[model samples]
Target: MFGIDVRTARVVWTAALVLLGLYCIYTMRTTLLVMLFGVFFSYLVYPLFTLAQRACGLRVPRTLVLLVVFAAVASIIGLVGLLFGNQIVAEATNLGQQLPKLLQPGELERRLPLPAPLEPLRVRLGILLQHLLEGGTAQALPVVRGLGTSLFHAAGNLIYVVVVPIFSFLMILEAPWIESFLASLAQRPDGRLWSNVARGLNDVLSQYVRALALLVLATLVSYSVTLGLLGVPFTLLLAGLAAVLEIIPVFGPLIAALTIIAVAVFSGYGHVWWLVLFFAAYRIFQDYILNPWLMSEGVNVPAILVVFGLLAGDELAGVPGIFLSVPVIAALRMFAVQVRLHRAARLNAGGAAQG
Candidate 1:
């Protein structure tokens, strides 16, 4: 083999195999993403699955229980979408059609007035916003030029929407085997490390799912009820949008608030000040109180670390990176803690042997 010794030949072969594996992984990254999303969804729904099975009692077969629960979930989602999806779509379409006209030069300025002292700032903000929108549309044009132009992306998105849930269901069916497989990969034969890993992951994952559910539910209910009480038009649409957007970190809520206010301004809603006040109060509640309380026992991460993770993730992998950043961080922290514990245990054992 090109004059290489046997050891060198083995090393080269091993390196080649490693590189080939990496290349294969890179090539199948998109499919891997879909599978990963399926797994993620399964994690979110696992607690619910457990609850459903428990409610079914021991007599009911587990697979049957899962099938029934899955059906119920699908039905509920379909019903809700049927009842509200059209209205939401219509509102979105109207907004899309009207926003360009509404954002024309001075239109925004005329709609949103400020005190004389801040009048110059208002004009500047309007100009800046127009420029941003123009730039954004220009950037987005290629991604959304037309159905024909974006067919591949459209198909990929369809795969995400349609296939992901089915894959998640399949993952749910194989959850126990998957967990065992994961545990078997641990270094310790006694399984203590795997136990810690599994328990830590379960805690964080369940808490994440619970926190997300609560945040979305609370946002939708509070926004809809309060806005409806205050006679806000498009209450359902706005509330639903905010609820859905709650899944995305930081920027999502900000965008929701801005959109709500913008819509209020455009629609001549007299309670713009009240809407602003409500959003500010709700934000304070969400940031300083609600989220902290929900996730305190789980990740318990500092806000600064989460911010850094988000920045790095966004830079490295864009939207999916942002979505996975927190989970990865929490998992890493758990792993670090476990490693420390294992090291301390080993040191103690060695010390006792010496004694």
Candidate 2:
């Protein structure tokens, strides 16, 4: 319109549309997150859906199959929560009460006898805690004041939880159509290319999700059992937190270890040293044996790339980014491999044409 040529006008229109789309996405990020989570969950449960469909001789509605799968999952979660909820709440309350005292200026010194050599370090820590206490109190007042607002915000999360399952059910029902629609965006010659990429990405994501789920479940079960046997308070709560954090990689286990040790110290658990030793051994076992065993067949993503992806994802988008980082990295790696293969094939074709 502003004296632009046809090609230039088309380019300007495309750029404007792209920017508008970006703005829309940014505005709807929260809803998008819920939908993305639903999609990922659908990927994880797709195989079960197929099996259920087959069991019904492919006569039952897809929605019914989804409900069965959802019911099964919800029942397991509800049963576990019912079994341990009260104990976890009580232990969590006690832990909350103890944490402030631990962070107090002289609380650590009073609780733990320091050798003469470490006395200076203890003094420094006390001074640091004093400064932190002053700042923390100021920060805590605002949080306390906003507690009611936070409760309302939490209520909104209920909608998100409801929406996720609904989205997942819909996604499962339309999965085949979605695949075809995506593939059709490419021309005939490139449709197969798009389909292959989609298939590869789907396999990688599903395998990673399943492997991660198994690993987390094993960690939860193993830790809960071991800690309970060792007479740890809040074993269920501690183990559940550990399982959830296990998804975060490297620092997750470290934080979980610290939490258990802190609880032991506060609760007068006599086996503090033993608990520490156990966590150390467990970390070694998990990193060396369990994780590789679970992930090796499916993910096989390099350690360095995983760590880097986690850092990058966390930096960019926080927890959701962290959760999706591994899958995204695997998909990117798959795309790179396919691109390289395609490039090689093109070069071979060109050479034959020249011959």
- Give the best candidate by lDDT: 1
Model 1 ranges off by over 4 Å: 1-22, 116-152, 156-162, 178-191
Q: Tens digit of lDDT per residue, candidate 2, span 59-154?
A: 787778789988887798799788888888988887788777676656654544346888778777667756865897899898776776867886
- lDDT (Cα atoms) of all candidates against the true structure: 0.81, 0.80
Task: Name the candidate that leads on TM-score.
Answer: 1
Candidate 2 lDDT score relative to the true structure: 0.80
User: What TM-score does candidate 1 get on C-alpha atoms?
Assistant: 0.82
Clash statistics: count for each candidate:
0, 0
Model 2 alpha-carbon drift over 4 Å, by segment: 1-17, 59-61, 100-107, 113-152, 178-187, 296-304, 353-355
Candidate 1 lDDT score at position 103: 73
Worst 10 residues of 1 by lDDT: 142-151
Q: If scored against the real structure, what TM-score would every candidate get?
A: 0.82, 0.81
